[model samples]
Target: MQIQSGFLVFLVFYTLITLVLLHAVYRTSQLIVDEEFHLRQGEHFCRGRFHVWDPKITTFPGLYLISASLLGPFKACSVYALRLTSAIASIVNAYFIFIIRRTVVGKQEDARVLLESISLAILPPLYFFSHLYYTDVLSVTMVLMMIYFSLKEKHNYGALLAFFAIMMRQTNIVWVGYILGWRALDLAMKLCLPNENHQYRLRDLLTTVQTLLGSRFMFVRVIKLIFSSYYGYILNILAFMAFLYWNGSIVVGDKSAHVAAIHLPQIFYFTLFFATFSGSELLTLLPRVLRLVRNRWYITAFGMALFAWIVQQNTIVHPYLLADNRHYTFYVWNRFFGRWWFARYLPVPIYYGIVVSLAFLLFAQHNGRPPLIVSSLVWIVATVASVALQQLIEVRYFILPFLVLRLVQPNVRPSRKLVAFEVAFNLTVNVVTFYIFFTKEFYWSDYREPQRLIW
Candidate 1:
């Protein structure tokens, strides 16, 4: 009966998310310029053609390759086809979440599942991402896969999954490389020596490096290279693309390269990176944030999110603040925070962030798990580190790490009474947010548009 109830709740939450995302994809189909590109790619990719050079004459072959690969049965890239792809990715993502919650947290967490339910169900930023169409949907799903499979001790499969994710979108190149390479080396060492913790010997490391740079081994070699030297992988991508453009088959437009290249003062960069990227040096903030969660954390988090939103307006013009492609999390938070001005005045993003943080911090403080010690620290530092990029919010970066605390940390299940209380309080927040967002403009319209306008 208990299992049945949990499964039922999960399905209900899943159903709600599906419905909301469908609405979002349909609504979003009309808004974003990127969606049009994705839609066109879905349409064009079905024909088995690859574009290397011209968007007018050729498209970005990468994402389209993904779409085409999925086109085994679909006829063309209509709204249904593109959205279907998005839907499939969402289901896969949700399934990954279910898997994590079930295995990582559920099995052991008699009390922890309460926290999981609250975090998964009511976290506004993550919830918002579910309804939208962006590379993040896929990137995050792959990230969960990487984490889950790696933890499950399926190193090769996990590495392969991480590889696929990086291929789909380049954002994870650094994180995935670090994670997969470390694990692979660890495993190789274990395999090489039956005892005494030996693997990936000195010679193995040299050979692996040679194999990647030399490309003698090909697929495996490239994988090793991607992990060994990620920047080089990105450069190889740019060089190959440049090669096509040089040969005249493709025309790469825009001053994005120029834009990304124009340097800001290192002082400003340092400040931005420091504030955004949390390191061991910054663990001081965690306790502060945790303390805030005891009472005023939601209000403080909301205010900070608003500030991030406000600053992000300038982030666009000065890519130094945020890369053009990044910063959606802040943007979304700004939007959700702005919803306070909607028909009834609500703070969807802020309210959720606050409550979620409260639950997470309080649970960690109360439970006191040993294994979670390092994971929690890593997540905190990384989440803070995420802000340094400044261009796009890409909420998944922080949210993913934030989520680890709930999953890996110990769970002393709150009482049925407390769980019921949290569930109710959180549901109220969600209800209010849905009402506000349904009636209002995009999430960050209030803070963002004004900033964008004033600047």
Candidate 2:
């Protein structure tokens, strides 16, 4: 019965998505923004022109190759057909979220899980890209599939999906490292003695480390365990290194525009981004925040100070951010964060609050379990590695980290009311953003084409 209901929910949502895609295709029949590059590359693949490459495209050809496979039967790639690739990938992503939720929650496969899956599937930032011909949707889908398979103890399949994810975006190799760390931690927990208090303490970890280092035989055994469990991930990492060596950089093209840098404020921006889309849940964290301030006021104060310093020193306004009015980020930066000197620092407290709340939630969920703690730490490292060097302040970059954080915390279920609010919030944002994209048109002086606002 639950399965039937889940299917019905998916069908309803899928129908809605299809209608949105059709309308978007009809209105924006010509390629827009990155679609011009993506569609042309996909068309190149469709024509079997493998050697011809676009100098502007930064990622690998995974999106085009996958779209070509699906469009092979028709022998042509239309605007609608290319956009359908991501639209369909979005549905598959919803299914992967559902299964990953079930896997994380163990036996609790209730209606709420289905609702949570659908909520995440239609998250405004992610869902917005589904109507366009961009790599974000398919890229996110592959990563989610990798996480799902990893949770199912299917590391080999997970690694394969991770490869596909890397092909979609070179930076995704960081996530592969995250999975490798998670799998290694899981193996370490299994090898170590069980904790009596059900909490992984510092002493237990020290003892485990000592035990592994105490004997060459034990060290070899642990090494064997990692190799047996995560050899596929190791191969993926090695292949990625080879690609880096051959290509001379992570990006395939447009190297000057996508150069890496120390953008520490990006993480702060991510906290605010998470808080915004988190709906009523952010408000619910206030009580915990108060308790934290009462208990660890010094730590809280230091974190806020650090966030302020990062914002003061490391806020980056990319050239594209200032030049492009077509993205919502342009107005967001111009109207808010970039408008005044204090404006950038204004969100520092919110960032600190969200980070504290997230830490509290993580500790509460894991109860200091070593594997889960290590996994959380691994995710943080992966997220920082993924976005800290990104020169552009793109919200789409936050999608994978946000989804992975939610997926890893299966025990943290929002109230049904909150869930409903989230879904409504996402739908409302999608409607408004798409409406603006279709209705609001301005022309660039340099290009003769009309530009529309988009996420």
Candidate 3:
């Protein structure tokens, strides 16, 4: 009865949030930079000229096609129609989060699942994107569904959803790689060494590698593993190549803007974002991390070195930040400490240290379980890889990485205090951000103007 009542309350909460977003459909008349291009792309799609490839286009046609199809009838209300599409996607995303958590933990975690579902729904990042007409919400929803089906061992369905996800956002190729790589690892372990249990640690990988090296006809086994496990990934890659062939290039937007250029600073930024978004999980792990590094003089020495770097570091602005850096996170950080070299830079190194220390601590704590350790490491790798490949910084890029924390950290029911803090923080940010979106009017006379108003 308690579980039923909790789910019932969640439904009411979900419905109320959804209704509020829907109410803003017409009122939020502003369009960010990407939206203008997507709206144009949708117009092109509506006119039957499907192959509207350009040097500045980096994304697939899935989003534009989706918007055009939905807006076909409501031509006059296209903007509202597009926003409505995102609003509906938000609700569906919340449902998937609920179902996935329930599937993972089973019926025993009814209340916890409800809490997590609500958390996912109201997470400041997801909530902010839920109000816009961009592809972030749709791509994230498909990615979550793909992950859910993959966990359920529904490979075919997962692959299909993955294909759609990549279609929505090219960066999602990492997810496809993650899923297929995991399967490959599992298969190689099973075939190469029958006696060993599957685990995700270096020891397991080393064991598999050493066994293959020592075995007769080792090359044949390696080939067999590749052939057996990589068929799905290969198919997706081929599809992506075909998409590029038809579109004239691998990316749809400005190649310079979207290309995979390595930026090391992203490692620091993303780690902090995850640590912050993970909220109390990292907080609760503080003791474990301290204990893990407590006696290591080298760690303490490195900590001091990191501290020095933080104090000396300065804000590194790229073309993106210079245009408009009005995001709440940036705004708040800058307002409080951005002016001071150490104050602004301090958080970056601190976040990096916390994430690295916590990860090593978890590994030491769970040394015997390779599968648990390895699966999480895979997401972290994907998170880093995704950000490293980006040309610019944006909070929305962190959405998938933030979601991947579910796989990284063990599922712990948030304490009442943590829950309250998250609820209050996300609610405040979303309400304020949405208010800006609803009232702010867009004028294309200056590109930087919109950036100052949003974020």
Candidate 4:
């Protein structure tokens, strides 16, 4: 309890500081473009209409449910008040972040890693997402919740959290992979088994081949079970029977080709998955490299893979970079790509420091490195390649790396050399990005605008 109390104290102090900074951004006229986007959808949901037809509101109703239940009619509040829920949710999320790190790094025994990770997460670029209505906050919030309950050495609370997070945002379906692995371990008693109910429906699932095959077959049925992580599988199976489940498409009219145009970016995303997941094939060969290079094998592979993967994903490798947001194009976006880091007080450098440090951490450490390290490396490389995939500098792409942190056995807080490298890399890129955003075609005109005009 004393440890929990200490964590809460530090978390509160950190959140209070973040809130002060974010408030300035909110008060400004130049707030994020998507800041009001979700709130508007909540407003629509509060009006009693299904949100499917509207492109922006097309996501699952979980977020809108909160909007309706908590805030009621969105029009009742001004835009800022409507957005207030997201900012608050962001703060609430930090508590979970701190708790998860404490649970993992502290071994439920220490607080240093918890404190350090919280400190790292609070850095500017990450901190900025908390204030905006962007789904990053909601998505990450759910992801962390999943990590927390799943990692409770004696409790299955983390798995339950994963379900809720997945429901709140479908994109987090990627996390289902982690939870499944955890469940496999739990079922076999291969790892720690919880003493408690661990917070899931404990009822026996009676599945018959006949029932499963009558309507759904093959991977379709397998994925329907996976979808149950978001929607109850039993219920989803029932829904599938009723709706006539089809693999990629059910409707004969078929608009996917056109939808593909709008989502041209996902091509990069899907390819990223291919590159990352398939890279594991090489890990099978790592023993050979390790025999030759020993501990340095980690560094060599990290450098070689990082470079080769980047080259493979770049526009010169493909051609998508020739399109919109061209310079930053491939899969992911770095503030360095568009060169906009410093326009706001948010520290871009700190953000990159976290990324590179994580990349090296997963790549450099081979001691506890096994499936987790391997997966983390795949995630980091592909997601970095995602910068070339997505035209925008969406920091949310780092979700895999963030979640991968949960599986790692704690290390002593990174060494000074490692920490300094991260800090230096982060700050340098941040300053460069700051310079770019401040002077760019977009930010300079807005920079000189009066604070009143900003409102």
Winner by TM-score between candidate 4 and candidate 3: 3
Which candidate do you rate higher for lDDT, 3 or 4?
3
What TM-score, computed on C-alpha atoms, does each candidate reach? 0.56, 0.94, 0.84, 0.58
- Per-model C-alpha lDDT, please? 0.47, 0.80, 0.67, 0.45
- Cα distance off (Å), candidate 2, residue 333: 1.2
Task: State the number of backbone clashes in model 3.
Answer: 11
> In terms of lDDT, which candidate is strongest?
2
Off by over 4 Å in 4: 1-6, 51-53, 56-58, 73-76, 107-111, 153-160, 185-393, 406-409, 416-455
Instruction: List ranges where model 1 is wrong by over 4 Å.
Output: 20-29, 52-63, 114-118, 181-368, 371-386, 392-397, 404-406, 409-455
* Candidate that beats the other on TM-score, 2 or 3, i.e. the better one: 2
lDDT string for model 3 (1-455, tens) is 68767766777777677767766644544565567676666667755567774445567777777766776655634566666777778888887877777776677767666766676677777777677767888998888888888778777788888888898998898887777766666676677766765544667777877877788686577667666545656588678778778866557667665556666556566666666556655665666666656666587668657655643552344565544445555555456555565565556547646766556534644323333555555676777778766656677888887775663344644565675566566678777767776676545555544342555
Which predicted model would earn the best TM-score?
Answer: 2
Which lDDT tens digits does candidate 4 get at residues 1-455? 77677767877876676566456545654444444457666667665665433454434556766666776653554456556666777777767766666665555434445444544455334455555565666667766666666566422455555555555654444454545543432342211123423322212111222333454554264454444433432332243345335534222232331121122333333333322322222233334444544556665556545544443454222233323231333323334332443321132222222333343444454334323332443444433433333433233554444445433433424444444444344345444543443344333343464222110
Select the stronger candidate by TM-score from 1 and 3. 3
What is the model-wide C-alpha lDDT for candidate 2? 0.80
lDDT string, candidate 2, 1-455, tens digits: 76647656785767576667656655674667778899899888876787878999999899999977888568868777777788888878877887787788654446667767777887888887877888999999889999988887888899899999998988889989999987786577557655554345446666777878787887788889999889999999999899889988889888989888999989888887888777655665678778887798899789889889888888888999998888889998999988888999888878888888777655554322333566777888999998898989999999999989877763545677887788788778878887787777888787677888777
Higher lDDT: candidate 2 or 4? 2
